[model samples]
Target: MDIVLGLQWGDEGKGKFIDLISENYDITARFNGGANAGHSIERNGKRITLKMIPSGIFMKEVQNVIGTGTVLDPVSFKKEILNLQLFDHTIQPEKNIIISKKAHLVMPTHKLLDIFMEENPEYTTIGTTKNGIAQAYSNKILRQNLRVGDIWSPDFQSRAQHILYRDYKMLEDGGMIVLPALEEISKEFFDAVDFLKKFTCTETEIYLNNALSKGKRILAEGSQATMLDIDHGTYPYVTSSSTTAAGACSGLGISPKKMGEIYGIAKAYCTRVGNGAFPTELLDEFGDDLRMKGNEFGSNTGRPRRIGWLDLPALKYAVMINGVTQLVLTKADVLNGVKSVAVCTHYELEDGSLETVSGTLSENIRPVLKWMNGWSADFVNMKSGSELPEELKEFLSFLEAALEIPVTYLSTGPGREQILKMK
Candidate 1:
C-alpha cells in the first residue's frame, strides 16, 4: 500500500492528484479527518468538492473506504452519499464504499462543545471549522463516544441519550444561554445516526490486512497536512488528530512496515486557512492577485486562505517530518503572469540568530526571501511534455535543489489532463 497526502496546509490540491492516479490503485482509503476537509477536483470541466468520501469515487475500478481513525459526522457523510447516488445511478455506495465500524461517530453535542470551547474566553480559539472534530476526538480519547458500528446495537438509543445528556449538562454549567430542548435535539441526532446506518459498515482491520496479504494495490490518502498535525505542528492552532505519515498506521490499522512509496502534494505557492503564524505572508497587492487568479478560497468554510510566498524552510520542514518519498507540485500555473516570485529561504530570530526550520513565526521572526524573475506561461494550452515552459522548468529545478526532493508531477491547471509528469 502507498500513501498520498498534503505536505503543506489542508488545501494543496490533493483531490486532483488522487483522481489523477486513482486508476493505479484498487482501493483508496481516507485515514484521518471527517467531513470538515475539502478536497476539490476538476474533471471533464466538472468541479467536484469532496468532503467526507474518498476522492477515488469517480473511478469505477476503485473501492473507497473511510477508515477507523476518522471522527465521522453522520449528517455530512449521509449528504455526500446521497449526492453521489444522484450523480451516478450505477454507483452502489454500499458495494463500492466502505465505512469502518471502529470509526467514531460525531455527536450533535460534540459540535456544540466545539463551538463553546473554541469561542470561550477562558481557552484558546483556534478558529476551528466547528464540525465537532476536536470535541469528537476528545470523547474518543476519554472513552465516552459512539462508533459507527454502534448503530446496529439494540441499546444504541439509550447509549446515545446518555452521552447527549452528559454533554448538555457540561455545557449548561458553562453558561450556555440558548439550547433546544434535549429531547428534540437528541431525536434529531438519532435520526442522523439512523441515516448513516443504511450504509455497509464493518471492521476494516481484517479486510485491510487481507488485502495487503493478497498484494492488492492500496492508496491511503490523508486529509489535512503535516503542518496541521497536533503533535508536530504549530500547537494551539493545529487540528485535533494526526495528519502526518504516522497517522496511516493508527488511523487505518495498517502496519507501518506495510507502507510503500509516500507521495507528498504541495502547491507552488503556500496558502493556509484559519488562524496561524504565517512568516512569508504577502499583505500587498500581489497577494490579492494570487487569490483572484488562483481562486484561493477555502473549499469548506469559504474563508479566504492567507496568501504567502512559497516557504522553502516551511516546505523543507514538512518534507522532513513526513519523510516524503516523492514531491508533487500543484497550481504551478497559478504563479504565471506575476511580476516576480519570492520564496522564503530562512528566518531571522529575535536573538540575532538565523534558523532554516520554522517552529513558529510569532512576530519576533521575519522571513528571509530569495526572489526570482516571475516565469509566465500558458501551460494550459500545452498538450505534450515537449511543450513545457522553459522558465517554469527552471523554477521547478531550483525548488527541487533547495528541498532535496524530486519534483515528480507538476500541475498546470484545474482539469485532470492539465497535470504534467516530470520527464
Candidate 2:
C-alpha cells in the first residue's frame, strides 16, 4: 500500500490531498489518531470536517477502513456519518466503511479524564483537544479499555460498567469532587454504541492482507504528523500515537515490505496549534497576515494557529525520518501578494554553531532564514506548474534542491479541484 501523511503538524491539508487521490486506489485506510485529528475536505461546494472517518469517505468506489491503531468514539463517529448523509444522500457509509474489531473505543469517561488532566495544575497541559484521545490510548495500553468487537459480547454492559465505575473511582481519588450525571453519559455512550452496530466491524488486517494477495491496491493515510509522533516528536508536546510511514505497518497490520511510495504533505508556510517550541514563529504583523490569508485556524479546536516562516531544517528532518518519496506543497496561494518570503534554512545555537533539526529540542535556538521574492499572481485559473508565477516556481525549485525530493503536487486553494499536479 502507498502512504500519505502530514510532514509538519496535524493540519497540513492531508484531507484535500487524500480526497483528490483516493480515486486511484481501491481502499483508503486511516492508521493513527482518533477524533482529535480533524481533516477538512471541500467537495461539490460543501465543506465537511472529518474526525474518525477517513478523508476518502466521499469516494463511493473506494472502501475506507479505520485501522486498529485509532481510538474510536462511537458518538462522534455517528455524528460524522450522519453529517455526510445529510450533505449527500447518495453517500452511504454503512456500505463503504470498515472498522477493525480490535480498535479501542473512546468512552465517555475517557473524555472526562482528558478534561480533568487538562484542568489539573499538577500536570502539564499540552494544549490537547480534550477529545479523550490520550486517555483512550492509555486505557488500551493498560488493558482496561473496550474494543469495537467487545460490544458483541453477551456481557458487554457488565464489562463496560466495571470499567466506567473504576474510572470514576480513580477520578474521585484524584481530587475531583463534583461528578457529571453518570446516567446521562452512560445512556449517550450506549446509544451511540447501538448506532455503531449498523456498520461493518471485522478483522481488517486479515481482510487487507487478502486484498493485497488478490492484487488490490491500498492507500494508507495518517493523522497528525511526524513531529507529533509520541516517540519521535517533541516530548510532552506530542500526540499520544505514532504519525509516520513506519506507523502504518503496526497501525494497519501491514508488513514493512508491503510499503510503497510515501507522500509527505506540508504547507507553504508553517502553522501549529497547541503549545510547543516554534523557533521560526512570528509574533508580529507578518505572522498575522499569513494567518488571515491562509485562514490558519485549527480544524479540531477552531483556535488560532501559531504561524511562522517555513522551517526547512525541520522539514528536512521530517523528510529523512519518514523516507518521503515525494513532497506535496499545500497553501502556496496563501503567500500571494506578499513582497518577500523567508524560510528558516538552519538553526543557530547559542554556542555560535549552526544546526538542522538536531537543535529542535534545545532551548533558545535561533532560526537562520533565507529570503526570496514573494508571488502575487492569481492561481485561481492556473491549471499547471507552467502557469505558476516565476517567484513561486523559484520557491518550489529551492525546496526540491534543499530537501532533495520531487515537488509532485501543489494545493492552491481549499477546493478539491484547486490542486495542480507538479512533477
Top-TM-score candidate index: 2
Model 1 weakest lDDT span, ten residues long: 357-366
Q: What overall lDDT goes with each candidate model?
A: 0.85, 0.90
- On a 0 to 100 scale, what is the lDDT of residue 270 in model 1? 88
Off by over 4 Å in 2: 177-179
RMSD of each: 1.6, 1.2
lDDT of 1 by residue, 1-423 (tens): 889978777799889899889999999999999878988877557776788899998888889989999989887787777877776667777777888999998988888888898779998888889999988998899998999998889998899889888889989989985377788778777777888877778888778889989989899989988888888777778888898888988899999999888899998888998888888888999889899899998998899988988888778888888788889998878988776788889898888888887645576688898888777777868766567667677788898888888988888887888888885
lDDT, candidate 1, at 340: 74
* Per-residue C-alpha lDDT of model 2 across residues 1-423, encoded as one tens digit per residue: 999988887799999999999999999999999999999999789888899899888888999999998989998898888888898899989999999999999998898899899999998989999999999999899988899999999999999888788888888889886367677778888999999999999999999999999999999999999888998787778899989999998999999899999999999988888888888899999899789888899888899999999988889999998899999999889888889999999898889999866515555889999999999877889898999889999999999999999999999888889999998
Backbone clashes for every candidate come to 0, 0
